[model samples]
Target: MFRQSLPAGIGRMMASMLGDSPPSSRQGADAFPSSQSFHTTATLAAIPDPYKVLGVDRNASAGDIKKAYYGLAKKYHPDTNKDPNAKEKFAEAQSAYELLSDAKKRETYDRFGSAAFDQNGGFDPNAAAGGNPFAGAGGFHGFGGGFPGGFAADINFEDLFGAFTGGARRAGRGRRGPFQEVLVGEDIEVQTNISFMEAAKGTSKDVVITPLTECGTCKGDGLKAGAKRSQCRQCNGSGTRVHFMQGGFQVAATCDACGGAGMIVPRGSECGTCRGNGVVRDKKTITVDIPGGVEDGMRLRVAGEGDAPPTGTQAAPGTRTQRGDLYVSIRVAPDHRFSRSGSDILYTASIPLTTALLGGEVTIPTLDGEVKVKVATGTGTGDRITLSGMGMKKLGGRSRGYTPTGDLKVEFKVAMPKYLTANQRTILEVLADEMNDKTARRTMNIGKDSPPSEAGNAPTDSQKNEGFLKSAWHKLMNATKNGDGGNSASNPSKKESDDAKKSDKESK
Candidate 1:
């Protein structure tokens, strides 16, 4: 009777071991009172250590634990294994895995045994009586006689099964969820070089890109001509496979055969154009408007110009798939004559020495055009001339009703003549003599002790007839002979006195 109730494979193995003729039904009934009584007795037995249940040591690593769980789950799955107690053993292994996989839970189980998770003092037969409808009756309740709150609740059975089944998660249908909305096409980055003037002012450019699009031959269905579609055998047209876990929970995973589409075509029935991929690479052209005041290395975002999303990855039911943005990195060529500092432009202008000394108008190049700037008479090298509103436009400063602009600073570089002609040299010499004579007379006047003759005081005849150049020259010559380089020419020497007296006598 026990052999009859056992799975065919298990029954054969047991019969071979204990002989063909086993105990009769009446004898078996006498040994075990009822199925419920037997289940309760088995569940109340001492719980096995989690490490032993998973077939690992106490110091096993997390990877080891995971490997052992996958091996045991595959071997004891109710769908594959025919053993009558296979479901119960699988539940025990799953429970062990759930506890040992978590660092905190594992530590608690190791320190306090299974009692750490038990709300009650010990195993309670009443708790098992409150059976899980999903597991059906007579299901084995292992640790603590029931499921722990944080143990099986936190385990994602789909992920655990998918690890062995090699499956993917299917996109849910309906209004776009947060996770679905974030599944946009990838953004693209490209680099382009532009002229300096183009970067200073705005310009437009046409960019060519090859983005993925739905195939025209298969109409994004990934089917060849004359090929018929049929429901997927793996998922039974639902596009997902449900796996029943030990704790009365179910998990759905994407069907691997049809890739969650719930349909499939026979081999060699795929469309030749897209090779059953549903998407193809196509060329697209988009115009990008680069704004003014954009600096080098600045990225410009062009919306909906990048690669398109893969087929069947649309957002909401009514909305179409969103294309990612295109980021264009700008590289500005260097200008020989102009350099920038913020919004201001710096330019070096060369001016003749004569033009610098004598005030004149100088022509300077600006972004607008060449303009004449007035140079001061005493302008020197390294002098800067600022022209208002002739520089780059302000980036974000134009909203206050006044369009602000930066100044164009022109730095002067005095260009002195390296070679002078004969006639020029002669003229310069004469000019130099005249300047020296004027300077000597100014020096003499500055050395006078008295301030000046008063209006009422008339000048004497001797003062009026005084020869300033003669007196200055005689004083200078006398001071030079006396080795008194530091002496002033205000006082006359002995020789000057004798010469003056003789000149006066001769005149009389």
Candidate 2:
């Protein structure tokens, strides 16, 4: 396992205990300190117990640990907490939860002690080298690179720090080696509104977005021409440093000098285009192809079109930066004449009452175009006429131009006339009487005060009386037919009696 060089206070104490010279910083060619000189020994640097940091016991359940972590996080979150120590407390809680929540990590910590992790924290599978925790499975042994039964090699201190902190160094990032950290940019979302027809037929639209792109001059390296790199003095080129706690427990933290890159270009050697940043803000126009039959609230994704990673971030030796995705949110506007259900479309068709009763061909709008549909006789309001294969195209289960489609349902609505001509009224009344529509007959008096017939026939006074008598005779005949024996009691009118007497005299 790789251990970072000890701090000044701890270094002096360790030197006194081991009877060695005080640790001295290494002087590099660039006037930068690369490392510290110390004796080779598998010494244990104390770290806060995961249980104590979360204020929980060793026997605490996962639920209890999580609860404690959440409480600490909410109380000491940097955005809400104003105290200077709050940020450190929040980090401590996060680290504790990360370690204790993983069963394997917690078990290992319990078995081998808090500073021991699988490969990174210096676990010796062989255990032959005096059970020393710093004797790594690889050839390397201890902090000074030599042990009684092990070989010498460089140690990757970043992995050691990550193992101690439950891999917080690469949290939320892509999987990469300890030397190369892959940082993915953040996704961007934009909303746009389209008309109902456009949604059905599909349309192309251009969207403008301002995102961070790689700096052309620096080629995303953030380094100017002839710039020389140097080892970071803070972490001694190890990319990490140690923090001692109250109980002599030491925690590994990221070094601030190189932003965890382990190396740096001096202040004057920055890219002119991005000002030492690997990215620059630029506006780009993208034409998005909106497939047909896309519904409202549908999102379209454009790969590799999102923003760049944060500023001053440098990829290690071999890794490359990854851009995020661009998402377009669609909003379909409603239409007054049309509505949709799945792939089916509904259209309301209004026709005159005469056309509904007599049946006629009426033109209606469809997704394809306007077409004449036959309206059945006696068609009432809310009646639907389905035109197969005339609706929106299906967006699933098949490729474009070969997919099945839905039907266009045309619903009928009878439109009543506001006013009727005198002739039309009279004809309707006659028709109602012929049909024996009692409601229509009572609602509109049929004959009294009616205009002359369309055939120019006007009834005289006698003709009117004769017509009255004929109506009475028919009523009596109907009564007899119904087994009433024509005994519906009623006195005869004077005109009717006089007509009867004249008819009797003529018969004699």
Candidate 3:
């Protein structure tokens, strides 16, 4: 146990308690008569009645005793109250709580008063000289010795101070025991554009960056050669200041003068290169790697390529300064001929109507080159042809042999001719007649009694006068077969009737 020196007031009180005659009655008496007398008085004054110190009755419950001690401690803690006597009052409250809160100590105190634990009639002057007046007893000792049942261990100094300081004691101001390295550089972000093909395959480009770097002149010391250093006057070299807050709370913060370094160069000796800032803006070229399969608006990080720390400051004794990071955002240009879906590419190719109906070989365009593809007979518009492993490659190769390659999907669009020559129309008409004959034969085999009339032939008047239902059914069948619906006329015209009768007679 280590004993702290007593204050002037406590020393005077101790001396008065040790003398045979009252010191106040003596003319021109010294305030602290002797060192021995001072120690005795301090020990006696320290051992006050626990019930009186805590402001509770002798029969008060343990809960009552704790509540009183807590209230007094909150009112007297040095951090909360700025009064000169706050520390002493808090110590008294702590001592009272230690004795009254314990069942054994409270019972002993109740029966014997202050003398129960003191075997001697009065405190020994010789023992007081040794610094511990309550050496023999385990109870009611000052802060200098161990308590009766390890009672001092139960007191939480952090908790008591934390209630008022809000844990500021462990913040940035007091983190370092002697010195520590701190972050002084900031990260930077920029955007760049690349072609669509460059994005599909990987490409690299050099980028110029202008950012702050350590000054070369004065070697980042922020001072000229042989400059003198001095303690910071603003914070008295402690690197922190106490701030009085709105709610009667005091908080500790870093001192602005020294940037929490506790030392600075004298006023007349600033380095000229960085103008005492310790850093300067400079241009640097960095090569960036663009991986395949990266999407637009994606960001890539480049390590150790950003701003540098300020000059005139060194990292903590065992640590190194860390450079900032560079973030590069990518923009990919759009391709007119192709579109993408995840890892797959989509393209559309137009084919002639003859190639769609007759079937032929058509050349298809791809990313690498052109390739011949077979257009199956009757291939319709909007039909898709897939070429495997012809799309963009995966960004980072593959996983499980899957997602390594994409397919190129080619969609077919049939192009119809708008006009035909007279000779070509005549040949098409003859082909149409032959196709109709074959259709009529096929229909007759399926239970039709009569074959269909030839081209330029028509039906008789009776056939034209058939019931409206039969006429409509025949018209609908013809429209569907020809792929065209005629005008909405219900009856045949005069010229059509005459032609139909002539054709019917000829057929018969």
TM-scores, in order shown?
0.46, 0.56, 0.49
Clash pairs, candidate 3, are 14-41, 220-312, 221-312, 278-311
What would you estimate as the lDDT of candidate 1? 0.59
Q: What is the alpha-carbon lDDT for the whole of candidate 3? A: 0.60
User: What C-alpha lDDT does candidate 2 achieve relative to the native structure?
Assistant: 0.66
User: Model 1 over residues 159-204: C-alpha lDDT tens digits?
Assistant: 3332233222222221111112123466788887787778677788
Per residue, candidate 3 scores C-alpha lDDT tens digits across 169-267 of 222222231112234466788888998788777789788899888788866667777875677797677565555544322345556677655666667
Off by over 4 Å in 1: 1-182, 218-221, 224-269, 312-320, 397-404, 423-508
Model 2 segments beyond 4 Å from truth?
Answer: 1-181, 253-259, 310-314, 441-444, 449-508
In candidate 1 the C-alpha lDDT for residue 252 amounts to 56
Q: Candidate 2: TM-score? A: 0.56
Measured over all alpha carbons after superposition, the RMSD of each candidate to the real structure, in angstroms, is 21.5, 16.4, 21.5
